[model samples]
Target: MKKSKRAITPEDLTKIEVLSEPQFTKDGTSYTFVSTKINENNEYEANIHLQQLHEEKSTPWTYGKYNNSNLSFSPDGRQVVFQSNRSGTPQLWIMHTNGGEARQLTTFKHGASNPHWSPDGKYIIFTASLHEDDDVASQKELSKEEKQQLTEAKSQEPLVVSTLKYKSDAEGFHDDKKTQLVSYSLEGNTFTQLTKGDYHHLFQDISPNGKQILFTANLSDNADYELTNDLYLLDLHSNEIKKLNERSGYHQRAVFSPSGEKIACLGHEYDYAGATLTELYIFDLQSGERLCISNEWDLQLGDYIIGDMRLGASENGPVWSKDGEKIFFIATDRGSTGLYQVDLESNLEILHKNDSHVFGFSYHKETDKFIIGISSPTNPGDFYLFERGSELRQLTTTNKEFLQEVFIATPEELEVTTEDDWKIQGWLLKPYGFEEGKKYPFVLEIHGGPHMSYGQSFFHEMQLLAAKGYVVLYTNPRGSHGYGQEFVNACRSDYGGKDYEDLMAAVDYALDNYSFIDEDRLGVTGGSYGGFMTNWIVGHTNRFKAAVTQRSISNWLSFYGVSDIGYFFTKWELGHNLMEDPKKLWDFSPLKYAENIETPLLILHGEKDFRCPIEQGEQLFITLKHLRKEVEFVRFPDANHELSRSGNPKLRIARLEHICRWFEKYL
Candidate 1:
């Protein structure tokens, strides 16, 4: 792994990169971010950069191959608006905070997005999607071959179904446009619409005397069976709006408070459904009252650490503290994600605890100085420089020359305990060029949000399965999220039971406290719910001498009629619902023990995975090739279920070369 540093190539996924939205600059002495990577046409680009706390490199303020990203900065920070898909899809542009040529602001036709400004910058605000009877100043912009003949004349009409939140593995079948809230008017350059129609608002925060605007919707006229999210607010000088949580719950990111008379948010209510635990509140706008300010906090606030080098959006929060009596945020606990604060009498503090993965932040509020962005497990992230009486300083080693040319590995934490006495935290790694008494071949690796969390970030497919020599591990077990809210609702209605006994007690405590782990060369893998726990661990134990799985499921009664959130994520993680529970969702599915799989699996999926949908990998590759076994499948095509996170970068390097050639052909 390191005679001269090498291992870590799936084409280094276009040379690693990522950084993210950070911001700061209303005289906080400059800052901006974005970065992202993978492009020599393996797509995904992202740009913006900036920096200047007396800089040491960080300049590219928006360059080519599109993806500029939601920027902002205006109130006397002299201009910069962002959100680009360069002339094609995402719109709003505006430039010049000390540089130039960016122009174009809003040429509608269902484009534009999250711009924001107004603190008297003569208003900007943004967000687009219209069609429930259009009209953001009559939605114009067309020609790109008339927007491909109006999307081939609206895909030849005839499609009308109602909605159970009409399909979304990030936009696939929902099309009544929704997502409103506009405004533009940089001194009447015109474009008004501020909130309208059939639900979907989202934007959040604009107040500090910009006369109100924070958002979140669910305008419940049965907002498609009320999957809650309320919080509203609106006013920008009397367009009056109001409604701020009488609580149903699933409140959202909110903000507004450096004396805008209170706001701060992040919500929850679904007690343990979707594995609940999100909390943090505080409301008040002239006496609406509220206050559950992390009611005795139990962690789980933001960044649910699942990596694949991020793509733009950060600044999770409650945010205030410019003497608004403290607020700040970013939570998840025992397996990383730090920076926290609490104050309006609740008193909490931490402000950057370690074991990394901070994910994004900016805050300066007159010298409390933060910047943030962290990530670790040997760095796939940077941007540091905190300050509270000094020292947390690192500004950007943006992967220091791709870490002096590769070889990462690290991990090692582990823990273990579980046959219900509980413990389970995890890490492991070891293989890359290791020597200490040979053995090796271990794998494991699970993470796919059984409520997301396999922490200490930076996981290039667990460093390409510990540089292909294996022994990787991973863990967080019981429905994950940094373990709280009763162990993340202890594996919901027990699918594959108690996160399969905390992943076979961390693989029997990594095969009895690791003696270089061979334990019969055990390899396993995972993807969505770690591909349904590698198809329920090769259909209930064959002690994995190689399995793969990827966008899996292997049945849950046709994943309650073809998953796009499988009809309420199988009654919020299998408590039962396809008419109360068809044989307990086919006795906890993995294709009901695919005729007791004898392990040599492989599967992998994502042919536009609408949340585990390549017919759940063609029904486990045609029932393990009709019981002949030793399966094989693959697929990928226009990828989804975030094909190994943020899909399509050469199919995420052909999904890590098909999970490292199916664990180097059976470990």
Candidate 2:
């Protein structure tokens, strides 16, 4: 096994807090999760914990450290199965729910993940990928000359791959190819292949009766439309796999109703022009008929307005209650996603709403309680249990120890009107230890996915900036997701046009309203599309004092050819392909206007980022240096686009710290 490394600096340790995968036992007496525990020696260790509440006292049922998590309890609650990489590759591991005798379930050379217990508790289903030997053999199948070429290709490290259409920030490590489903039996010690071939199947959920499995996959004939993944039902008895949803749309988050009579899932039907919108649908198990339960107006998932039914940031799939009469889910169409319980019989009524992001949830029918996993811009991830509709009670405080030791700023929501008369949403984070009438530097942080929303989730960089005495501003501009499809598609072909205006409008609004914000000391930073926007912003305006772009797109023309998903994303997102119009790609590239940038810019990238590619960073870095502009580059090895979320925890922390260092020095 590759030895785990520790963060060299104390600042690095403090910045990265490891807490994820909160799961509950059947009786609701205990919970299991994975988190990093920092020892007194300052070394970080990954751990899995089984915490139980007894006599009003929380006791550690079982706690051990070795980089484990993604826990799921068995139906009987006798065992807890999870995935871990301690065996060199991520594989399935199981231990008694009470935390005894941990056993490795799968010894396959290929990695296995996302373990789900069967209802009868006899088997476990998980996703698996190709083995290293298979990878090598596949490459070896080519002719001698071709093999030599591939070997040479493997040996030669990635250069500034300028020939491609789209380049990811760090680029070229492992080609994330196919992932499939498999089932294993505990008694027989035998594994069965449930799903086969090149397509990927993820987020698997078993039917209540253990008769079938529901998952999302893109196995359609039109492989080009892989982005439009649909739900599929796999019959364990007949080994038959059938597509569930009919529309040439996207379907995901399939959950079986308690009675096994129906299935609730989020359906996204896509028309031409490429708009991704989600709607809640309940499919009758026997009749194959689906009922659309949400407002027809591009229903955003997550949290909703209680009475009037408005959408805010919903893209969350529906969750069935213990009795299955009520479907609990989070939708953002109304406000930031709070917990909402929709009565399936009443056509989905909103139950609870909050101005925070609620991602995971569980309904306990026995106690008539609901457990929700929520996060905000200030708090990362924590559990909240709701009983009888009284005030919600917080269960865990994973980051409380660190948060108490540090000064953190709270963000204020600002409703600003755009020139288009649209009221865009934004939040301003004042510096910690903030004083009135004191001017503070500010950083405009943009989110990627343009389709992805920045919810009330704990952001290390945001807090770090606030700790560094900089007011941070982040907003969901027009092109951002969580609003309806109309809002997301608004920036379709006009990438840097209106979306840029919305972001700028947010900054303008914050500056006008927040007296403590220093306009001259402003800086900007973002990743992916946000990175593209940051590149666009600095070139268009010298208003910001400095900027940092992480895993950004400098040149769209190159991105279309180099990155793995470049061919599709460029065409779908930009509405133009290199084959259609090369000049159009160049016109939108940030590198096109690199000559105009005067901002002291810092560029950070991963060495193995396939989404944005390292070339994007090198291109921008070289251009800035050539222009005699201030620039610094930090490259993290073996990291990807997801580095901010779940990459090497310490490196993730370093990335946040480095960005703060740059903004503090330049802004």
Q: Write the per-residue lDDT of candidate 1 for residues 1-667, one digit (tens) a residue.
A: 4447878878887888888888888888768888988878788889988888777788898888988888888888888888887887788889888887889878888788888888878888888888877777767777689989877987999668777777777777887888888888877688888888888898888887887798998887887876788888988778888888885888887887887888888888887878888888888888889888777777788889887777677887768878898888888888898988888888888877778889878888888788888889888888877888778877788878988988788888978887658888999988778888888889887888788888898888788788878888888888888778888888888878878878988899889888888888898888888889889878888878888888888888887778877877888888887898699888888887899999888887878888878988898889889999998898978787877668888888887898899788888
Clashes of 1: 3
Name every residue pair that clashes in candidate 1. 449-452, 527-530, 527-531
Specify the highest-TM-score model's number: 2
Count residue pairs with overlapping backbones in model 2.
Answer: 45
User: How does candidate 2 score on lDDT?
Assistant: 0.72
The window of 10 residues in a row where model 2 has the poorest summed lDDT is 305-314
Candidate number of the best lDDT:
1
Please state the error at residue 550 of candidate 2 in Å.
Answer: 1.5
Candidate 2 residues 1-667, lDDT tens each? 1113221232534444545455566897666555565444444455665566333224543344445666778888888887776765566888885546678887655567788999999998888775322431121123447557776997886644323322344434345445677788888878777776656677557988998999898886655445677888889999898888787677777889988888988766765344566677888979999887774545577432121001111134476777888787767762367666667654555555677767566666667666666776656666666776598878777677655555546678878799999778877887766677789898999988767777666666676677677888888888776677778789988889999999999999988888888888999999888899999999999999989898889998988877777887888888999999999999989899989998888899988888888899999999889888888889998888877755665676688778878887887
Q: Per-candidate RMSD vs. true structure?
A: 23.0, 7.0
